[model samples]
Target: MQTTCACHPLTMENRASAAIIVRLTGEYRVPHDLILTILTVMLGATALVAICHRLGLSSIVGYLATGLLLGPYLLGILHESETIHWLAELGVVLLMFTIGLEFSLPRLLASRQLVLGLGGAQVATVTLLFGAALAVAFGIDWSLAIILGGAFAMSSTAVSLKQLGEQNELATTHGRVSTAILLFQDLAAVPFLVLLPLLGEQAGGIGHVLLFTLMKAAVVFVLLAWTGRSLLPRVLHWVAESHSLELFMLTVLAMALTAASVSMLAGLSATLGAFMAGMMLGETHFRHQIEADIRPFRDLMLGIFFISIGMQLDPAVLYQQLIPILLVIISLTLIKGLVMWLLIRGFGYQKSIAARSAIVLAQGGEFGLLLVSQVISIRSDEAGLLQPVLAGLIISMLLAPLLLRNNETLANFLMHSGDKDDAKNAIDNGAQGDDDFRDHVVILGYGRLGRGIARVLIENNIETLAIDSDPRLVRELRLQGEPVLFGDASNPGLLQQARIDQARAAAITFDDFEHARRVIAQIRRFNEQLPVMLSHPADHDDCEIGDDNVIVFDSEMESALMFARQLLVVAGVETSAADLAVNSVRSHDYSELRGVGDED
Candidate 1:
């Protein structure tokens, strides 16, 4: 029996390229150099990221470090190439697409105030202030300064949202404020990007170029939006019917890339096109599935993108201009943060909210790097300032995760505020008169279980306060006059505002055992005697809480008990007897039902 070889037969092009490949003793012609390059990057990324993970840092830090170590600056193994650049850019496009999924047109319109008002104010003021400073300090042309300023005004949407989300603070006031400003910044980056090339190519007639670009952008947006609204649903429905995962993935990629290409061809940012595509698909029923399917691609690509960013930094240049880079980083993080705080405070937000928002958005953004790169390409004379600014921005991005992780602490320290009560106060504005809700239930994790509990409690004329980390849910409930506040329930300040100490009982309705435990721990910290009830799946081993006042409700077990009770009643057993049996099982904490359906 003959075995088939998987090696590609060497043709003319292969022979030409073969000179670049190291010969190995195998019929299978593997590109050893390419494999080795990929292996080196992967191994470096894995080792550094693992260390970062162990040290409780973001993986992005590790990716950047990997690039720095392997890039031309240090090891000389990897040099910047267009292939890598294009691939890295694709990563950003996918990222923007995913973000657009979360911000549908309706949601965008709903948040017009933040997206337009606070967001508009933030972009305009930061641009003007930074532009004026650069003009005075560097004595650069006003147009160049303004271009650089627009870039500086942008905070990293990818960095801020991901870091804030991991901390479970996305629903907090600062998180909301940061998100709003970032949304507008993403929108604001498009025009700047369009103008960058025009400005670089020529010094005059920029207004005409910008106006033309905007018209093209508007046309492309409308076409994409219309396609997404009408054609996309049917196309996706057909894809789903085919029941092919590969096909589905390909289709999603096609949509994203096609949209991006169209925008790029039209002289607009590719990310804007991909983002719009995502927003369009977000309206379809397949949004969740699409998001889930695209996540792995987004994450991997985004890692590559960050690594490429790291590769761009020149260590020699960095060392030569250390002081200036340091100053730029400080101004970008500290002075920029101050500006944001003042701006947000002017919007009538609490000091804590304002301060935290400032910290969250202090760093320079990816768009800023894009602008700086353009300026460098056009004005090599300004490399002295531009290079340092670029380096400074990357360093600030590296620090962003650490800053966001401790945003609350930093906000408190910077504002000279003692507690998070102010944050709670700011979020609890909707619950104004409900502060007097004594002897009421405080429900955490207002999903199905929490809402069910609230309905029953309200039906019985008992006041109840519900805390959920879902901003949309909180908004909806608030509009309906429900005493719901958007926040992480585990925060002591939020719990305090919920009057946890004064409540008759507290319920932790989260399905995750660890998450529920955290809320319980926080509640115990404040009100040691408050009767706490937590929900968990039936298969979980018996909880070992030391507090006797705490109760555990196993959802699966409760359902089984109800089913058994109904079966008994249907079998002609007395209603009282069925109730007694169920009550007896409940009294013993369902010990007999534990591990009843084990597969082993």
Candidate 2:
């Protein structure tokens, strides 16, 4: 005991920690390098996103840039790790689930004209155009042409959803139309995924195999749907009654992955299965909770998915095919955007909706990437041609957000370019705002913090419009004669109803980080000049650049700094020294929260 005890102070505990680490790194063959890669990827993403935010771009762009910077095409810090791929796959699954969660049977039925009709026409038209051009112009194989064309016909769902959700435009007329078209694309992807091998083979009947797969998938879907309709709600209800959050999360994941696995076993895409699972889960009362719980996973996975996409663009290869890449990008964007615009307008939407929706859905989608990958896997001989198209598709996705961000300007230009009638609303009743609200503040979240903010505003004789998701909270607030509404601030309709455009300022005092982000984002989209205050503790790198406009009340950071200053004062530090020490702590806290500018 004496020999090992005090000589090294904590030698035994330190030895044990080292022993465990060695065991993890060496004994059981753990993926230490993979862990390192993940940490770096996150750090790199944070930095890139901070920079991109400062540049007034979406965070999705930063994730893509991170992949390119660290991928094999560049520094090669993390090269094609299977872990990253797995994360990307999970992200896609989560994305599908979210889409399903947001959309329901009733909503879908209401939008059938766009989802099935306009969406179908766009996909078919674009595929035919691209395929015919390739087969005729380049004389490529008909099979390869079909695969590539179908891929190009699809638009990036991840990019579209992120951008639209950020702007809280998913409920707008244009947003609805674009969303429906995307849903069709998601469903349409299944056939292409199955048909690639069938079309590529020289076998007796690839069609037979595809038919068999579809039959199996249909049977599986029906069975899962039936089970969902009958047993899922009860299961979720029982779990909810138990009040075990961890258990509930586990059950949700199990059900989703299980259904997805069954679908994969039945020869359909796992992503499709996840969508089905979400549809089934959407029927439960726990849908909102599930949506909230799965958000963090969805976001992390989405970042990884985007990073994987970025990794595909090798600068050298892209430069070699620069001309072809540019041609493909222009053609895809122009053709697809035009088709979407015309199709949307033909469906009775306004010219504004039609034009913006067209630009929004014009890019090559994630489903397109899926088809391209499947074809390449089945027939590697086409990789050379497919790679260039892949680059073009990714470039389009990167540009899609920018196009959407400035859609109003672009749509206005289109209106003034020749057709001014489109600029005028078909109906005056479309205006949703309260016309009399001038110099009012909009408050999101009616929690304790929100109530405080509202009270303070009212005391100052400032009018306020408040929104909260909790029905009970809204009822209570209304009984107290507070100007609070039972609405989701993340909904663009509510923001419009609150007259955000005419508001003097806005405050988001909610613990729900995701919802807060959406509220801020919607505000940004609605009135980029508006001053908004977000009452969240998270130092989200993506929102750091807008700190001035999107003010964050970081109470924790302030409290810590205060504590440090007090400690210094108590330790007999002079008043000036204490102030200096407090300032240093505050600055350090801020630096910890934000990033150093473009740290090379």
Candidate 3:
């Protein structure tokens, strides 16, 4: 395959001159090295994720591991490609997008106590405590100490949320507390992002610069919010009316890229813009479909971001700075965990919930890496220490899932040793009444299609626990006393939370191909005998990897068949003849479903 790729393939000129020929034609768009790097990363990451899945590890670890192996310190397959660097930026944007999709004003208001009360305390207390320690211990400049301290105050939103989600603990009081804290950190990080660069700007008065930036950000945000309220839906409606999945996807990409560009031009991070775009659109009914379409892109880009982060870990440096790295890791986990726990306890949470949330949020988050890198860029003298600090951060994140997996045991060992665990206040992190939900159908993606399927099941007196990520939908349904929960249905953690073990069947109506694959894979793991109704979108190609493997409901094909069947009857053909004709077409399509294209 490689030889074919390198040989005289798909070009008028010989392989030796094909690249040159393309360059001569003023179409030297992408470099061959960039192409090779992308292919290498994809293949390596996929294989590693497959292995990790079998070993019950998160795919985030797999992507990071792939980066470490291919990094400059290892095989050197990916040599810090600039293209990959920028693409990694897109990963951050997508992360913000996912967060925005799940964030809504009502939910924010609902968690106001935690966000404003506990969240505000965690940041303020952690920052002051850590910053003071740094200043006193190392005699670093007070300003830089505060900067690094605030940066370190951040907990990993991606890691913590995913960890909580995987353990089926995300719906618990502790999980909500953790999520609320993370959300505050996300908001806090925005100010830090604006402040980081300004700290390096020695010319202007620092306070004045900060004020100016804040004012500009406010104006830009208000403009975008107002525009989104009036303009975005109309654009989406027009594109949606086209009935072309491709166009709909293109429209989404355009919106994200355009908003990101405008934000960058307006002096804010593209990621902040992306998040704003998502939050603005999140309130609309189109959110589920938007999330489904954006999910695949988001996942791939997020993987790439993790890989880029992994690439930053230099093994040689890690070996040389092992002692300091260990010290940093231990301090970060212990201090941050203690601070978080105390804050939660002060807020009237149970000891169990507080301790567990502390452990979960103790690690250095993905955003910390961003801050570390940013500070180092603004202060080159700190470069040497930042590298090892980053290495420690990565290690902590990789260990997060394992820590969360055994959190209950860990929490028990920490407190109330000789007592029978209090079932009332003790958060049920796993196996919460699965036996009670037996024989119920699990509907992934509680959107239009999933809801319709659920309504039908309900009509027949079947129970359903609809899992979704849209905050608005989840909030409304729960208030109306419906059995729906907000979570990423593709995640096994969410599935377990929905009590997959007791589920009799499932309807995978998610419109995104990637998420659908995840949902199907997770279902097969829990119960191979359980029936799955997967949705094949209007955009299935023969060469797509998952198409042949899973039996899915093809909406486009079924709709076409329905239209044709009724048309035949209207044209005077017998009902049975039309039915036979439709069945024959269906059979023929099914036979070729797994087949390669004619040329292949």
lDDT of each: 0.81, 0.75, 0.76
lDDT of 2: 0.75
lDDT of 1 by residue, 28-134 (tens): 57689989999999999999999988876668778878888899889977887887788888887887887777666666787788778899998898888889999
What's the CA error at residue 292 for candidate 3, in Å? Answer: 2.1
Better model by lDDT, 2 or 3?
A: 3
Name the regions of candidate 2 deviating beyond 4 angstroms: 1-32, 138-143, 161-172, 194-200, 348-353, 415-421, 424-600
* lDDT for position 58 in model 1: 69
Better of 1 and 2 by TM-score: 1
Residue pair clashes in candidate 2: 154-365, 155-365, 156-365
The 10-residue segment with the lowest total lDDT in model 1: 426-435
- TM per model? 0.69, 0.67, 0.72
lDDT of 1 at 431: 27
- Which residue segments of model 3 deviate by more than 4 Å? 1-36, 139-143, 416-418, 427-600
Cα lDDT over the full model 1: 0.81
Q: How much is the lDDT of residue 505 in candidate 1?
A: 95
lDDT tens digits, residues 147-191, model 2?
A: 788898898777787688777576566776777788888777766
